[model samples]
Target: MNLRVRVVHCACAGGRHWYADIDDADDPQPDDPFWFVDGCATQTQALETACGELLALSDRVVRGDWLPRVLEDA
Candidate 1:
């Protein structure tokens, strides 16, 4: 599976915040282990957090410890 991480920003009355989402590059979906990071005060912080999560996920995938939601459900 080709995984991609995306960072998004939002500005509201509460203030500015950032979020990150991890999904498949070709076909995205909401599934288990769908990593997310939110409420970051800065874009840099959100990107850093997303990078760390992506690295950890890659390690898990390499070690055969990661499972896609579809497989898990089956």
Candidate 2:
């Protein structure tokens, strides 16, 4: 069960921003984390913030203290 997390970035009308998502390499239909980080002024800043958020979320998931939300329609 390999969980892969990645920081993705893009440019929008507001500015540059980044977000993170979790995926299971082994399972294709697993519950998607549907997690996203808030926008930042710079890509670097957004990525840094996203990394921290992802780490916290991942830790909680590991400890069975939290369940990732499924926000495909959100």
**Model 1 off-target regions past 4 Å?**
30-33, 68-74
* lDDT for each residue of candidate 1 in 1-74, tens digit (9 for 90 to 100): 77788888988887889978776777644544357777999999999998898888788888988545434645
**lDDT (C-alpha, whole model) for all candidates:** 0.76, 0.61
Q: Which residue pairs collide in model 1, if any?
A: none
- Give the distance in Å from residue 53's predicted Cα in candidate 1 to where it truly belongs: 0.7
lDDT per residue as tens, model 2, 1-74: 35566666767797766655555557566456535555656667766765676677678778877454557546
What are the clashing pairs of model 2? none
